[model samples]
Target chain A: MNPSDDAGRSGVSRRSVLGGGAAVAVAVPLAAGGAQAAPAAEAASVEPVTVKVTVNGEPVTVRVDPRVTLLDTLREELALTGTKKGCDRGQCGACTVHVDGRRVLSCLTLAVTVDKREVTTIEGLARGDRLHPMQQAFIERDGLQCGFCTPGQVMSAVGMVQEGHARSDDEIRERMSGNICRCGCYPSIVAAISDAQKVMR
Target chain B: MRAYTFTQPRAVREAVTQAGTDTAFLAGGTTLVDLMKLDVMTPARVVDINRLPLRGIKLDRDGLHIGALERMSDVAADRNVRRDYPMIAQALQLSASAQLRNMASIGGNLLQRTRCGYFRDVSTPCNKREPGTGCAALTGINRTHAILGTSDACVATHPSDLAVALVALGTHVHLVSGRGTRTVPLDGFYALPGSTPDVENVLRPGELITGITVPRSMWAANSVYLKIRDRQSYEFALTSAAVAIEWRGRTIRSARIAAGGVGTKPWRLPAVERALTGRPATPDVFESAVRTAADGARPLPHNGFKPALLRRTLVRALTVLAESR
Candidate 1:
């Protein structure tokens, strides 16, 4: 089977459990089908580890395979699909997220390492109807086309502003180079970030 | 990725004890995890050392002590590092992406593997990956291979921008384990790709890098790192230079230089430094000194342009440093 198909098979959505809407530390039981498409013997022999992490704001305890990345965990287990997966490798920043208020590539981060740490994804950036200033600026500046890379760009832009390096266009371009825009929305993205950085400052 | 048992060690001693023959230490996970996914490195046990208390960045009488666990972005943004060692800051800023910089640690950056496609692709034969398999890049598409310090077994270039800068400034890598502690110069830390390209470094089985110490010098504050890559940002270097020079009036007092993207390891240009040691900082002197920058280069078929590019990059870096100060 193809790898993408395996990734989809791992997606046993936990949306219903998460929609409970309280910051409670809920321990969800692991499903047999939630395991990766490894050999039957290997899957049975391998043990899953328990991870206690705070996503968005709610504390979540999940039993996942040791090798599962935070990107897959966020997309498949938690059903926070806003954080796209452009390249599973670290080459693309599509899976960028804030771990302890610092931006990091979720694709390269193992879920177990984020145990007891706070995670912020693209879904967490909005508050009710009023969106984040950066998100609103992205919409006003027409910063996206296909919208595949928008989540990562917005998250990275927010992080760049927090890092205090959004001083100039060149600096912004350099700092934001991690997230690739396949649709080439860099000009509009820069404009959007420029607009948002002022308010963010 | 193959199945592995993961454990988080609370202390350095615990982390060291958990490491074994088929085990890997996970920090940042930028290099190790990427390779694990590619199947190039398969470890049965993974020891996560993120919680180890090794994050320290300070300048003392011994020089700048940078903890191995310190993230790349934090080290680059440190006020003292920016003010005293601009080359280190520039190298760190110009590396991977901002997100990667936030995740990658200083020690992990030094141990990053080469970006050679042949080395990365498991289908192809790569001596560096699997010894005795023979090198695919020796005759295949090798436009980005090393032009210096290459052997018949391998031609992949070293991939760290921060390493070139640290080597130029006389840095030492500190290591620790259950056995004891030892220090090695950054220059001698890397092993040449003579016949055994798989043995990259001199680290023992369970030795963990604790930190690095960069020697304090007058030239460090005036130093700079210049990287010429395929693109303007977020790419590996095609040809890069890290230069630090101390001047006596208009004449050069001491000079240290190292090059990247053209050598199996961070290539030090002592001949070029010797040529410029007592000369006046001028265009003619720079042009003449850089002539020896690529002294014993052995360029492959596709990477023949690297020798010339290395010389030009060095001259440009020196010119920029001379004018800035």
Candidate 2:
């Protein structure tokens, strides 16, 4: 979660992910009918599972708890936090990531099951300092409110655009129904993704 | 959440051997992992059977054999499944979110647990979870309870949309146990909630579902899956039906219809199928067929709207089929 390495250029300060409510909520009650009263370290005692993931363009090996979700591993272990943790119950699209180039909810997926498979997180979407076109559109259209759910939204939008799925506003709405925005920022979000889709096409 | 042991078994024999000792088989882990995270299922050992080559999709002499490990997404996109068995493909595609469909397997989908609030809670007294504990779903906040298969003990409906379509297809299941291999009609695999709601399936100890065998049929080519719920997507069916038809020129030769979100198991409507066979494909035929299909269907206090909704969905589905025919 330390963004000190590339903060200045992205204009995202370390304070966004550290020493704030954003960092605190990650450890609080995860969701309704969910446990928010534990630490990620406590989950480590369960089992030290080792799995090799062919992530994006590279193969990376990590040891984690057997209970660790793919979403948690991306954010906590690899610092690939572009996959958001909206509802964390597979109900929301904020945790959307790609497994072998197909969209999947990272929160509902287990790291153990993704072994030796190609996983694309939001972190790998951009080429070096170049922003992913979808990310650029979000900025251009102001497609965010609190920004907690932006990363997951951006990742999902990237998947839809790359797949040529957003043929119309209705199609976009149906495809994006999996993700929810409490701030009612869907209009702008859809606009941003649609604009990006035009460019990607 | 106690710790559990994990074993990756590459063969069926190795998995069956471990299944004898309180082990749960892991396929896609979509539903199982969610339940486990909620502390609903705490198995002592988990047998990861993904290494086995059970992810098959093919058409042969006997029928279609779909491997147990085949993901829902793969099945939905399969050429044969889409072209021939439209109901199966549409049902699989209509379930859950895109990510879930990608991770959920056919076998796992068939065996998914009920989405009942009581069954999911560790603190709740569910007959399915702990036999003789009594069901809280009987009269307590039973909005999503089943009406077709209800006893005083339980009322929760089975939660797979794809299984309903498979039932309409008259699919048979292949199981591999330590003793040997055997096949059972999918309709008979699930048991009613009469006295032992806990024993939901007839699966013997150490028996693993190998694949699904859907017999070759002329009806498969003209099929549809219709799901109706509170929301447009990612929600369980309120009253859904899977329809497949065989046509003799302008007349319907045979029909396969089943209901979901309204039964203890995926319910095959014999009455409806009987009505459709040998009748000319028409709007009147569709209406009468749906009426007979749900005849004598009992509705609970909350789910009474389903019988009517089911009929409408069937009419709409049959009309679609008629046009296509």
Clashes of each: 0, 2
Model 1: runs farther than 4 Å from truth? Answer: A1-36
Going through the candidates in order, what fraction of the true interface contacts does each contain? 0.81, 0.42
True-structure RMSD for candidate 1: 4.7
Off by over 4 Å in 2: A1-6, A9-47, A54-59
- Per-residue error (Å), model 2, residue B140: 2.2
DockQ per candidate, 2 decimals: 0.53, 0.36
Per-residue lDDT of model 1, residues B47-141, tens digit only? 89999999899998779999999999999999999999999999999999999999999999999999999999999999999999999998899
lDDT (tens digit, per residue) of candidate 1 on A1-201? 854366457853344335433244334423222334556666556677888899998888887777778887776677777788888888878889999999999989988899999999988998966799999999999999988989999999999999898989988898899999999999999999999999988
User: lDDT scores for all predictions?
Assistant: 0.89, 0.80
lDDT of 2 by residue, B1-325 (tens): 4456677788889888878656678887878777877777777777888898897899886778899999997888788889888899999878887667767888888889999999988798999888899887766777677878767778889889999988999899999989999999999999988878877888996689989999889898899999988989778998888999898999999999999888888988988899889999888888877886566566776777877888898898888888877
- Chain B of candidate 1 versus the native chain B: what TM-score? 0.99
TM-score (all chains, Cα) for each model = 0.94, 0.89
